[model samples]
Target: MKRRKNIKTVIYHGSIWIIGLLMIYPIFWTIASSLKPENEIFRNSASLIPSIFKWENYAQGWQGFGGLSFSTFFLNSGFVTTMVVIGTLFSSALVAFGFARVKFRFRTPLFVCMIITLMLPSQVTLIPQYILFHNLGWVNTYMPLIVPAFIGGTPFFIFLMIQFIRGIPHELDEAAYMDGCSTFGIFWRVILPLTTPALATVAIFSFYWTWDDFMTPLIYLNDTKLYTVALGLQMFSDPSSVSAWGPMFAMSVASILPQLLIFMFFQKYLVEGITAGGVKG
Candidate 1:
């Protein structure tokens, strides 16, 4: 029996390792290709080892085009991502608190409407949103990309926060109210502090989404100097000409570092937040 159990454990772990490697193969390939000479990139794409490690790919990629370095794109991405994350957390938390705690007229209907938006595909609203932004003279600017986040653009984040907030005990709110805390005070002093794990989860997700967003940036940003890393990476490809595969792969690897670090640091909080949100008090 023990031998059978040990065999099962080995099989389970072996399967998991195989799956993990398969999932990460692309990333390994990208990294390996980044260091390889351009001629060898596609020629020996299946191999993890490179014949010649061309360290200059990083430098070439960083040099960028039209007098703008890749640093500009990184900075632009950093700024936009930072603002979006802040806006998402602030707006989602405030809106979630209202729906989760404060009782007001039409509140249920409004919550229902908000929930309905979650089911609507973003592409359905894309054209209308673009026209609206265009009319508002927000076309070709970061406004279109960044403003919606501050206005609670992501219904999913609000929904996540609402679920997490609902799991908190009402007695805590009552205790805070007894201490002369107003509604906002209860949220600020009590609810917010206790929702740390959820907030971390939200922040990490917000960072990831905003950083990786390509379509929105592609639609709004036309100036090369104002491009984000996503757009910057796109510049490396030319359908009519030879593409800079090595530099593109190098930049791609660099682009993933921030997300990898974020997940590594906040993975615990992310798991706790997700599990906690599903449970009720």
Candidate 2:
């Protein structure tokens, strides 16, 4: 029995390592390729180590085309992503709090409508959204990307927060009310503090989605100077030919750092948040 159990444990650990490596292989390949000379990249694609490391990829990629460097693109992405995180946190928390706590007329109906919207695909409303933004003269600007978030935030975040808040006891609300706490005060002082894990989850998700968003930025932004990292990565490649693989790979590696760092820093919070938001709430 002991031998069989030991064998099973070994198999489980080995399988986990294998799966982890398989998942990380693409990222490893990108970083390895970034260091290789352009000609050597395809030749040694299967290998994780480059025969000759060309350090110019980072320099070339950051130098960028035209007068604007990658600094501008990074700045633009940072700004948009920051605004999106803030907006998603505030708006989603407020909306979620209302659904979770407050009694309102037709609240269930409104929540159902929000759920329906969640099922609706972005592709379905793409054309209408574009037309509306164009009419509003929000084209070639960050307004289209950032403003919608402040208005409502994502349904997923709202729902997650709602579930999280529901897990909080209603007695707290009653107690706060007894202390002459208003609805807003209860939310701000009590509910908000208790929902930290859920909020962290929302912020992390919002950061990733906003940072990796490509199609929306591509559609709205025509100016090269206003491009985000996603758009900037695409800029390294041209359709006509003569694409810079080395530089593209370099930028791709750089683009991953922010997400990797966020996960590393918030690893505990993320796990707690997801677990907390998943089961009870």
Candidate 3:
């Protein structure tokens, strides 16, 4: 019996390791390809080992093109991502508080509308949003990327916060209110502090989404100098000419560092937030 149990454990762990490797192989390939000479990239694509370690790919990629270094792209992404995360946290928390705590007319209908928006595909609204931004003189600028977040543009984040807030005891709010704390005070002083896990989850998600967003930046940013890392990576590829695969892969690896680091550090909070929100109070 013990031998059978050990065999089962071995099979289970072996399957898990194999699947993990299969999933992570692409990332490993990208890192390996980045270190290989351009000629060897596609030639030996299947192999994780490179014949020559061309560390120069990082240097070349960082040099960028059009007189703007990759630093500019990084700075642009950093700024947009920072603003979006801040805006999302602030707006989602405030809006979630209202829906979860406050009693108001038409609140249920409004909440239903917000949930409906969550189900709506973003592609459906893309054209209309573009036209509206263009009409508002937001084209070719970061405004289109950053402003909507301040207004609770991502309904999913609001919904997540609302669920998390609902899990909190109402007695806390009542206690605060009995002490003469206004609604806003109860939210700011009492509720916000307790929702740290959910907030971290939201911040991490917002950062990841905003940083990795390519379509929005591609559509709005025409100027090379104003490009984010996603757009900057595109600049490496020109169909009419030979593409810089090595440098592109190198920068692709670089682009994901922030996300990897954030996940590594705050992954606990992310899991906690997700689980807590999933359970009703």
Specify the highest-lDDT model's number: 3
- Model 1, 58-166: lDDT tens digits are 9988887778888999999999999999999899999999999999999999999998998899999999999999999998888998899999999888988998899
lDDT assessment of candidate 3: 0.90
- Best model per TM-score: 3
- Candidate 2 achieves a global lDDT of 0.88
Candidate 2: the clashing residue pairs are none
Each candidate: what lDDT?
0.88, 0.88, 0.90
TM-score of 1: 0.93
Q: Write the per-residue lDDT of candidate 3 for residues 1-281, one digit (tens) a residue.
A: 99999999999999999999999999899899889999999995799999979999999988887688889999999999999999999999999999999999999999999989988988998999999999999999999999999999999899999998998999999999999999999999999999988898999888889999999999999998899998887775554433678988898888888888998999997787666556642
Residue range with the least summed lDDT across 10 consecutive positions in model 3 = 234-243
Flag regions of model 1 displaced more than 4 Å.
241-243, 272-281
Higher TM-score: candidate 2 or 3? 3
